[model samples]
Structure formats: C-alpha cells, structure tokens
Target: MTTYLNSLDYARYLDETDELRHFRAEFLVPERDGQPLTYLCGNSLGLQPRRARQALERELMSWQQRGVEGWFEGDAPWLSYHRSCQEPLARLVGARPAEVCPMNNLTVNLHLMLTTFYRPTGTRTKILTLAGDFPSDQYALETHVRSRGLDPAEVLVEVPLRAGEFHWREADLLQVLDQQADTLALVVMSGLHYYNGQVLPMQALAQKARALGIPVGFDLAHAVGNVPLHLHHWDVDFAVWCSYKYLNAGPGGVAGLFVHEKHHKAQAPRLAGWWGYDEARRFEMTQGFVPMPGAAGWQLSTPAILPLAVHRAALGLFEEAGGMERLREKSLRLTGYLEFLLQDINQRYGAPITLMTPPRAEERGCQLSWLVRAEGKVLFDYLGQRGIVGDWREPNCIRLAPAPLYNTFEEVWRVGEALDTFYAASRPRYPF
Candidate 1:
C-alpha cells in the first residue's frame, strides 16, 4: 500500500503506485492549469483510452480505402465488428459470449429487452423498480407499461428506500417480490445504486425472484466495469449497461445486454429488427423473423460501428490489464483510502458531512456519496473551482468516484483535502 505524508504529496505517491503509474498513460487525462484534473467522474464519463484513437483511425482509413468492402476486408471487418467486443464485454459482466451482446444505447437496449421479457398479461402485468432509478430507466418502464394498456400508476411499482437510508435492503426488496409475486412481471433495479454507489446483492435477489418464477433484470449503467459481476452464474434473467461510464468507451458508446442461456429459446415478447435475424441468413432478407439464439437476438438495428470500434478499443484495455478482478482489488483499497481521508475531513470540519455510500467494501463500488450538512451547492462549486472534479446530485449530495483503472490513491487523497478546504472556507456569516 502506498502511504502519503500530506495531501499535496499524493502526486509522489501516485508516481510510486505500481498499477496506478501504468494506466495514466493509457488515458487522455484532462489538465487543469498544467496539473491533471483529479478526475473523479468516471461514474459519469470515463477518460478516453489512448487506443481508441488508433482503433477509430483504422476504421476511418478502412472506410477511405475500402468503402463498403471495409465490411469484409480490414484488420477488423465491420461485418463481424460487434463480435470482437463480445468476449471482453462478457468477461466484464460475467456472462458467456453467447449470453452477452454489445449493441444499442442503454435505454434502447432496455426497451428492446423489455419488449421480450416484460410481457404483462392477466395478473402478472406490473413492473417493479426502485424508487430513485435513473430517469431514463424510469421513463422506459413507465412508457412500456403504458404502451401495454396498463396504467403506469397501477402497473409500475416503485419500491421506496427506508426514510433515512440511501438504498433498499435485500430483505425489503425480497419482501416486495414476495408480496407482488402474483402481479409482478419484472423487477428491474440499478445493479449499483447510481447516487449512492451501493452494489445490490444481485445473485441473492435473482435467486429469490427466480424461485418464485419472476424474471428479474438489472440496469447496470453504474455497476458494469465499476464492480465485478457474474450475470451468468448469478442467473440474472437479463441486464443492460452503458459503456461510457466505467467501461471508458467514448461518449454515447454502444451499450451491452446479457440474457441468461435459459431464456435463449423461451417464447417471450420481442421487438425485432434485421440485425437480429439469424446471421446465417441475415442477408436472405426473409419476411418472417427468425431470431438469433441468444442475447444477440435482442439487437434491433444494424449497430453504429464507429461507436462499437471505440468500445472495442476501450475493452481491449480492460482485457490487457488483467480483468475486473485485478481492477476491483485496487478499487477496494483505493476507495477505502478515500473513505478514511473523508472521515478525517469530516472530523476537521466539526460539521456533519455524512457518507451516504455503504460502509462495507462488498456493498459499494468506487464512488462515494458525501452528504454535506449545509450549503452543498456552494461546497460543490468550490470543489469544482479547485480542480477536484466530483459531481453533485440534485439536493445535498456530492459524488466522488475514483475509478481504479485510471484513478490513483493520490487522487483520492487530493479530493478529500480539497473537500476539507472547501468546507472550512465556505462557512457563511451568521447575522446575530
């Protein structure tokens, strides 16, 4: 473990870090006044991988050199482009190659999956989700329910968190599943709570729901690549995740989906497109939809290859750097270090700045949500000005995510110090 003498000495500590030192060169880390921005925002947009430029340039060159033939000729043929991403992505999500498909953006894939899996009929028409899921997920569920002739008010149920808690406990979630077993068609929750970075116990939840014959899905927008997952082994019915966050793909990169093998042949609702047609006869242009066997069947349109190329480039880094296990080992230590530093800062302030993210290493990811007692906005902006790039949630929470792939222990310490300084300097005068 790397040790730091003071906050400013973190830079030297970063230099000494074995894993930390190598990955900095892999990304285009933005600089603030000649110093690299302490980028704690990988929970939003990950840093661009140095290899993406080469990957995209290869495609651009192929397009110029081969035109449409680029589909078949290049080092990476566009015809089988998405396949290149499958294994790496599957490894990240803990699914088999056949069970995972890299395609469509996050919401699009959600809607596509919902079309097949969220078949509501008779009593089993309701969709259950967490109360504060990502806005896009909520919209997709509500819209899908409405489209199926079920009122969102009646068919879409949101399981609320405990009054003072930041996330839903597994027991409470299971109880809801038990209560709604008859009516619940689908239960979708963020695999990791975005705002608080809680990693839901997906295996336990999935097992419980499956035993009751309920299909459970997960929106892994904040979880994938940030934490280790085993969607296949966990028997997750299906899952959707974006690549831009911890996956380090470029903005709006292609998203990924996982469908357990058990559902590969199951008769279910699905929205079809040509890309999902059996690859053997995809060019046959058949009138009837003969879908691919597994998760690939959920693909709706011919994927935008440019974004996929970028994703492949980023995924290669994950593959080369040993895998999620190695990344996660560092993540636990780095995040724990940040938590320790933050607690020190809270003590120094003599003000209540509580951490909303769970304390256990297993229950959380790299992100930490700190709830400032007062004037959160002022403190957030002040941290921004200081080049500590954390994000603020709507009310009083600030999220600092030190991604393991590219972030260092030193950056964690710097962010904590910046928060401490901001809290001390931002106290407003009382008009006595």
Candidate 2:
C-alpha cells in the first residue's frame, strides 16, 4: 500500500513519480484563470482527449476528398467505421471482439437489448432492478413492459436500499432474486450505482440470476470504463454503455453493447439495417435481412461517422494507457488517499461531511460520493468557485472522482484542503 500524507509537498512528490502522470497532458481539462481545474467528474462526462478534434477532421477530409468513394476507399472506410471501435471496447468490457459493437447511444442500446432478452412468457414476466437506477432505465423498462400489454407497476420489481444504507448488500440482492425467481423474465441492474459511486457484485448476481433460469443484463453506463469487468466470464447475457463518460468519447457520442456469442445465431434480435447485415452482403442490395453473426446484428442504421471518429480516438487512449488493470491499481490508492484525507478533515475540525459510498476499495471505482450534513449547496458552490470540479447530485451530495487517466494526487490533496477550509470557515453560519 502507498502510504499517503497530509502535506502538499508529499502530493507533489507522488505526482512527480507517478507512472501515469504523462497521460494528464493528453486531455483538455477545464480551466479557471488559466489554471487547470481539479477535474474529478469523469463519472459524469470525461475530459476530451487532445486527439479527438484531429480524428474528426480526418473523417471530414475523407468525405471531402473521396466524396462517395470514402465508403470504400480511405484511411477509415465509412462502411466499416464502427468496426475499428469494437476491439478496444471489447477489451475494456472483457468480451470477445464478436460480442461487442459501438453503435446507438446508451438508452437506445438498452431498449434494443431488452427487446431481444426480456423474453416474457408464462409466469416469468418481471424485470428486477434498483429503484434509483438512472431514470432513463426506469422509463425504458416501463415503456417496454407497456408495449407487451403488461402493467409496469405489476411486472417491474425495483429494489430499494435498506433504511439508512447508501448501497445494496449482496445478501439483499440474493434474497430478492430467490424470493422472486419464479416471476423474473429478466434482471437488469447498473454494474455500478451512478448515484452513490458504489460497485455492485455484477458477477455474483449474474451467476445467481442465470442459475435461477433468468437471463441477466447490465446497464454499465457508469461501470464500462471506470472499473474492471468480465461480462463474458460472468456469462452476462447482454449489456449496454455509452462512450462519453469514463471512456471519454465526447458529449452525445456513439455508444456500444455486448451480447454473449452463444446467442449469435437466429436467436439474435431481428433488429435489422444495412450495417447489421453481414458485410459481404451489406452492399449487395438484396432482399431480406441476413444479419451479421454476432452483437453487430443489433445495429439499426449506418453509424454516425464523425462521432465514431471521436470515439475511436478516445478508445485508443485506453490501449495506450495499457488497459484498465494499470489504471485500477492507481485508482485504488487514489480513492483511498481521498478517503484518508476526508477522514483527516473530520478528525481535525469535526466537519459535518459523511461518506455515502462504501469504504472498501473493491466496492468503489474512482468516485467518492459525500453527503454534506449542512449547507450542502454552499459547500458545492464553494468547491466550484475554487476551481475544483466535482459533480453535485440532488439535495446534498457531492461526487468527486479522480480519473487515473488524467487526475493527480496533488489535485486530490488540494480538494481535501479546500473542503477542510470550506467546512471550518463556513461552520459558524450554520447550526453546529
């Protein structure tokens, strides 16, 4: 374990020695007063890689120079544009190249997967998920159930956290699965909770769900690039994620999905389009849809090329960083250092901050969600004014995530310093 200290000099020394420190220069961090802000919100939307703009321009030049010929002839053929993105995405999510495809945005991909996997039949027709999952997921499940002529209120099972708890326990998840085994058609949950920065036991829950004869899927919008995942080894039936967050693709960029190879035959969803057709026959101008063999079969349209260019540029950075394993090791120590600093703040001044995420390093990613007990909005605004870029959730929580790709220990220490000052200076105005 890397021993952390409360001194600024120690932070600078750690940053100076960091193996991944060079990566910070590759991104466009948001700045205040010509100084880079302490950007800790990769969980929301990642900072842009410096290469993204140039990659998009290369695609634009291909369109201009080759005209229609760009589809077949260019550095990146428009026809196979989305394919280049798949390999890196597959590696990130721990699936085979055939099982992953970058395509529609997160929710659209979720609906597409649900169409194929949420196979409702006699007695098994419910979707089990978290109550506070991303609202788009709730809406998708509800509308999909409605399309099947079933009442969402009747068919959807939402699990809430235990009273006063910030995250779900594995026992709570298993018991719900056990009690509702007979009624579950599909089990969909976040790989990591977006609200609390907590990682759920995706593999364990997946194994149990499969054992109960229920097909399981994950909405990995927060998990995909934040932590290490083995969707293939876990035997997850299907999964969906956007590329914009920890993957750093860009705002409103193309998204991706994963489908186990076992379902690649005729059972794959018949959601058809030109791109989803087998590449050999895709441009043949044929009749019926002869779908591509794997998760690529889920495509519904020709991919947006420029967004894909940005995605490709961003995904390549992970490959350059030597994958998530290297990042995870640093993330463990980085998040722990943040926690240590927060505790130090609490101990010294009796601050009112409460950690909402799990303390265990394995149960978290880069983020640490904090519940500020009083003047929550004030503390958050103070953070913003000081050029610290943590995200604010509803009511009273602030989420700070130090991306291993760009954030440094010096930044984390500065955040700790800011919070300590904010709490102590502002304490007299609020009731102690």
Candidate 3:
C-alpha cells in the first residue's frame, strides 16, 4: 500500500525513482503552444515511437531499390516480415510465440476468429458478451450471428451491470456464465473493458467457461500492452487486438490474433487465403489450402509490410523497458496517484464528479474514467486548454490513461492539478 500525496515534489520523486522512466524518450509526445502536452490518452491511441519513422523508411528504401524482389531479398524480407512481431507480442500477451500472429486489423481479426471459434450447434447457439461493449466488438458479434442465420437478439447474451452501477461485478458475471453455460456456444468479451476501464476477471471467466465446455475468446484492444495477460495459461480459446491504442504502431496499424495450440489441428471452419498456406510450399501455388501450424495459419492476405515495420519498432521499446511486469508495476502507482488526486478534488469540491472505473488497482490497468455531471464536456475542454490530452466518450465520461512506458508521474499529477483548478474555479456554479 503506497501512500500518495497531492504534491508536485512527490510526483517528481516517483518519476525519478521509476525504473521505466527513461523509456519516455523513446516516444514522440504531442505538443501544444510550443510545449509538450501531458498525454494521458494511450488507451485511445498511443504516442508514436521515435523509431517508427526509421522503420517505415527502411521498408520504403527497400521498395525503391528492389521493386518485385523486395518480398524475398531484404535482410528482413517481406516474405517472412510478420514473424518479427510475434516474439514481442507473445511476451506481452503471455502466449507461446507459435500461438500469436500479427496480421489484419482488429475487427477483421475478430470476425476471422469468430468464424472459426463461434461454432453454434443444436441448443448451444449463443454468444455471450457484456453490455455497453465497444461498438466495434458489438457489431462484429451481431453480424457474425446474423451470418450464421440466427437472430442476434436470441443468439447474443449480454451480462448487464446491476442497476445504478458503473462497473460489472465478478460474481454477477460468474453467475450469469453458470446460468447460460448450457446454451452458450461461445464466450467473448473484452479483457479490459473500454468504457469504464474495468479489467474483467478473464482467468476466472475462462476457467468457468472451460469447465462448462464453452469456447472462450477476448477482444484485447484495451488490455494488450495495457496490462499483463496470460492468455494461454488462462485457457482462452482465441483473442484479437489492435496496435494503434496501446501498442503505439500508429493509426490503423496491423492487428494481432491468438489461437490456442489446442485448436491448431481442429477441423474448424476458417476464411483462409494463400498467405496462411504451408510456408515451405506457399511458392508451389497449388490448389489445396493447407494452413501453416499455429496462429500464422490464420493469415489471409499478404501483410502490409509498412505497418508491420512500425509494429516491430514500437514493440522493441517494450523489450528495452523490461516488458509488461515492470511497466505494470509503474502503471499501478501512476494510475493510483491520479485516482487519489481526483478523489481529493471531488471531496473538496462537494463531489461534483463521479469515478466510473473500478477503485482497486487489480481491477484496471492505467486508464481511469470520470463522470463529471453535465459539465463533462466543459471539463474536457478545460483540460484541452491546459494541454492535457484525454478522451471524452459521448453522454458524459472522460478517460485518462497515463501509459507506463511513455507517461510520467508528473504528467498524472498535472492532470490532477488541472482538475483541481477547474473544480475550484467552478465551485460557485454548483449548488452544493
């Protein structure tokens, strides 16, 4: 239990002692009015890594020097380019390298994984998810269900948060799983939820689903690189994630997927292409589709080398910063400090704001969601004016995530400072 103080000196002391402090230099933080902004929105999109440009340019040079030969000639040949992303990603998600693959974007990978994993048979014709999930995941599930000729309303089971609650309870989730286990064909949900910044009890959920003979998967868009995951050990059947958010691979960067080794030999239905063919015989260009073993077998089209290059470069920083364990160690304190400051401001100002994210460090990663009454947009704009970058979800939630890799303790403190100033200045407007 670390005691937090609402003081700039203490924030700097925390930053100074942080083992991952120097990793901040590896990224290009955005600036406002000739000064670096306190970026706290890595949960939405991570800052570009300094080496990303060089990585992309190297691929560009290869394309310029060798047109058609670029696929087979370079030191990091385009033919096997996506492989460079696997080891680092494997470490982040806690899967065997063979189980992870960097390929299509998030939704595409979700659809692909769904096509293979969401096998509805007889009475077990349902997909279980959470209410208020990110829009993309919701759409994917609905569309996939409809594609299977099943009514989405009947096929999709959502475990709703209890009335007047912001976060879902683990017990409630487990109970729902137990009740729906007999009919569930698949269990797919976010590992770390997007709207409320809640870290779902994935291990428990997976264990329960496994015991009940239901296939389980996760959308790790908000979880991967934000928290430490053990997908393989948790017995998660499949998972998908985007790189732009926490991976810092730039916008629309190539995404990744994980297919448990147990499913490798299963005769599951897949939307396959030539890239997924047996690598040694890919050049043979024969008719039959024989997918390579492991997650690489999920590939469809030729990988976009430029994004893969950027992905590799961004992942390198994780290796240099000593991986998720060290990054998550700093994340708990950094986000914890921000939570403390927000609580103090709300307490002093008559509680004009509400925190939607779970209070426990174990129930979240780095992001914290705040509900600022009707003045949510006002507070969002105020923070923008002070060069504090965060996200505002429609209706009334502001999300601020101080990434452990590039963000500092001082940045989190500055957000608190800005919020404190806003609350103090606007106290007269509220009728407390």
Judging by TM-score against the true structure, name the best candidate.
3
- Per-residue CA lDDT of candidate 3, range 132-153, in tens? 8999999999988898889999
Model 1 earns a TM-score of 0.95
Please, what are the lDDT tens digits per residue for candidate 2 over residues 151-268?
9999999999999999999999999999999999999989899999889999999999989989999999988888999999999999999988999999998999999988887555
Q: What's the CA RMSD of model 3 in angstroms?
A: 1.0
lDDT of each prediction vs. the true structure? 0.85, 0.89, 0.92
Q: Is candidate 1 or candidate 2 better by lDDT?
A: 2
Which residues of candidate 2, in runs, are more than 4 Å off? 430-432
State model 2's lDDT. 0.89
TM-score of each: 0.95, 0.98, 0.98
How close to the true structure is residue 359 of candidate 1, measured as C-alpha lDDT? 91
Q: Per-residue alpha-carbon lDDT of model 1 for 81-141, expressed as tens digits?
A: 8889889988999999999999989999899888878877789988878898889998998
